[model samples]
Target: MILKTKKPVVLLFALLLSLVLVGCNKTAYINSNNISEPSELKEALTQQNTVIIDARSAEEYAKGHLKGSINLTAGELTINEPVKAMLAPQEQINKVLSSKGISNDSNIFIYDNSGGVYSSRVWWTLKLYGHENVKVINNGVNAILDNDFELSLDIPSIKETNYEAKEVNSSYIATIDDVKKAIDDEDTTIIDVRSRAEFDEGAIPTAILYPHTKNLYSDGAFKSTRDTYLNYNDLGLKKDQSIILYCKSSFRATQTALLLEEAGYTNVKIYDGAWLEWSTKDMPKADKKPSTPATSQDAS
Candidate 1:
């Protein structure tokens, strides 16, 4: 008689071993080059090819903004598409960039008054759309103002150019199916970057609760590269581990995603639908917490 059970057991062992080896061969990486200091930016802005994008509200930009900077809000870069804040289509991004006089070769610098949150959003969107020559101002617009850079109400004349986006790389984004598969995949980690209060209300079951604020320092700047690497590494996530990030609408998730990718995490993807789409579906959610608010220092 053939021993059918023994063959099945051996195949399972072989499959598991292959996965283990793949994880072991992957290397961890950490870098801090994407962040730009104010002094360096001050000199760079004098060059004709350098472009500064102020990612603030129109009202705020009208009040005052960096001289020679183009005013573009994060809202201009998204679509409802049934899911609010989803990254807009490539053609739409092209129009927005072209209208702002942004070319693919421009040495672009982005910033916002609200820490790096809004600026990071723009930076991530550009990177997703294949513009690799971009940087997020460290600590955001405040850093520039603190350096005595004056804000101008005068709008510099913009000579629009044809700024066509390159073919998008779909690997940077995730879909509902990816999340479902990742939920059961040993190699993947699903992260929920919502506030603790929001997370406690309900989150993807098994998703790690890491609030977006955790990526920021007390003064609103992003954590150093080493600190950011340490924070995620503490979660037992290997550098090569597949990560799916989502927040209420994945906006905050983008901030975390940017930091992770900058630190050399190669497999990061954003769940564009985020909780908005996930909650409406029949998928599982986390157990509700106690009536008392989360007291953890990292909560929200």
Candidate 2:
């Protein structure tokens, strides 16, 4: 009877060992196409292929950040030569990302404190550089900090790796001439993703006001995919037509582009220089009420 009991116990231990091995092999990652929540980020931290990006200034990141996260600010991906905050060189971006220990297969999670402004810029930069395994943390830094998860002051030791830049996808971006051409095209739709107050002051001729915040909820999280689709659908937008987005600058445009693209809108493009360049060039501009009060025209 003792011998029989020993045989069963040994078999049970072997079975449990196999189960543990299988669990260890399992990978945990958030869906790249979806906006990631704090709970999902918590699970992603347990996975080996994940990398959290603190999309804030170095000084801000030094104060506190999600554990195991690396700092990558929007300023790093932009240059101020010909225009302020335009995209940096692809090779430079590749080198910076490689030095940060980001591999091609790494699942990047980006977050920032200023709403989704900074985080969305990084997200667009990565996507433009051909990184598809990326997601902006929903509701930005507030969502993460509110969860009461531990913040780390320690900077992680990164193991640098080679990261090659892929072929450029220019279709994702639009130029002033592109906007001019779209102005004449009936099949194209120009969207101004700024506040109604700003739109009332002055806007691109024929551009419709569809503020980027319309894509989010009161809590600051992105709405459901179905709801996002319906929201844009109410604007009479068909996925087949060319959709152009712009704001005072291009950050908000990038945010709206991401939301619409995820909602299945194809042929989407962003006028990178946006109203700043448009207004500077003496292009056709209009206001809802021409006699409205003057407001700040700074491009921030």
Candidate 3:
């Protein structure tokens, strides 16, 4: 009985299987592509190769956050005092990344307690520094809780890591001058993604309102699309329109832009400068009050 041992083949197969398993355990880099779901996130974090960032206030984070999440409040990035101190310069960001044991290649997911406010800001900031593996938690805290993931109160020990900033990508952001040019260009439609009050008070000279919030349900998530096309049609927005969106800051505008893109809009841009920059700049704004109707006696 000559039984040739297939031991070498079996060993090669075992090695390949091990390599596949190891690759699967590595952190998944997210971008516009590979946007992970809550379940996927749970699995990814379990592998211990990801950095979950809570883009909410430290207090809010303390109340509840995804397990093993690090805090870098979005408010801090926007010049708020305490949080800002934690993120004043690139050195601060590097320090935070190091403390969290995050490296330049870490898969980062940023979420906020509020809807999309701070999370989107963090998304924009990470992109500003040319970090491509970062993503915003689509529904923020709601997504995590709804997904039945556990939370923790333990603070993670900081581990220093090196982070390098690259030149900002001009395409991901719209400057005041870019907005001015877009307004003057007839082909572009500036959409005010703020509330009705914000629009009524005074908005970009000829911007139209297309509020970001909608009442719809998708597994407890806010419906990204309006219930009816008539809502957007009433605002003179056509399917082919090139739209620019702005809010108090770029936060809401980016959310609206994302929703618009998801809703089948072809050309969309976010004016991050938004009202914060618009109101301060020497630019035309719609007057807050409507002109009074002429008296009957005064009418010719």
Candidate 4:
């Protein structure tokens, strides 16, 4: 008869082994080469086949843009109340993709001037449309200049290709109806990832402000665990809750989505159309309550 062992050593060893196995299984698959340095992008540009999209305003693009890049302004999409309408229709998106010689197989790199607000939006949009080989160039134009990449003032001629547009994943996007339904359901949490002014002045009837920046220029290229904890904790968000994030036009929301996912929030979705799409129609907006507004500064 053996004496009673302390802490059940054998049992504890078995439990530790099980935890190790579980940790190995919980892998996060973030898109690669998506937020690379300008040097990496420059090398990719010189490759035989690569599509670079300049997601800056036309004015900024006209001033100066990367060589061999196509223009797709993120701000113009929001000028119209309903931003969805501004987004090229499926046929138009397909047409442009074809005109730019971009196919399902082409490796695409997208970037913008204001941090990654536009570039991330384009990245999420491409993913929504089932284009998996898409990446966002972090730090936007400044990163290119810092890396000493060449810029061109003249627009290059685009060669058209036959690109087919497949159905987009609705789960990744939320419509006005979906937001309303989530409010009515009471089981879901709707997060407004916009500035406090945007949220307090008037916002989706029941959404709480969870503002987040695109995290390219100041806060590095990707969201880390600490960033998630700070943002989520400040907003009083629960890790287990089913969260939906949205911003003026889904740019910042996409960044928040990535952060939430990194924070172990299993069910997270981005309302790509966001407030730009929600506020356009006669959708309900929360009454403005006088309160201290949160700043849109980069999370340190």
Location of the lowest summed lDDT over 10 successive residues in candidate 1: 291-300
**Candidate 3 residue 239 C-alpha distance from true site, Å:** 7.5
lDDT of 2 by residue, 160-237 (tens): 989887765788899999999888899998999888898887888778887777666555666555566667777778
Check candidate 4 and list the clashing pairs. none
**In lDDT terms, which candidate is top?**
1
Sort by lDDT, best first. 1, 2, 4, 3
Stretch of 10 with least lDDT, candidate 2: 291-300
Candidate 3 has a TM-score of 0.71
Error of 3 at 286 (Å): 1.6
Candidate 3 lDDT, 1-300, residue by residue in tens: 235557777889998996665344322223343234576577668665688888888788787777788998665555433211122356655655566677778788877755566666676666666777776666678778877888888887777767665665656566678788876888888877677777788888767665555312332233434322334555556767877878886676766555454455767667766787678778888765333222221100
Task: TM-score for candidate 4, please give it.
Answer: 0.73
Query: Which clashing pairs does model 1 show?
Result: none
lDDT (tens digit, per residue) of candidate 4 on 126-235 = 76677877777756676777777778888988777898877877777766677879887666888887777777767876677655653322434554455555556555
Q: List the residue pairs that clash in candidate 2.
A: none
TM-score rank order? 1, 2, 4, 3
Deviation (Å) of 156 in candidate 1: 1.3
Q: What is the lDDT of residue 49 in candidate 1?
A: 93
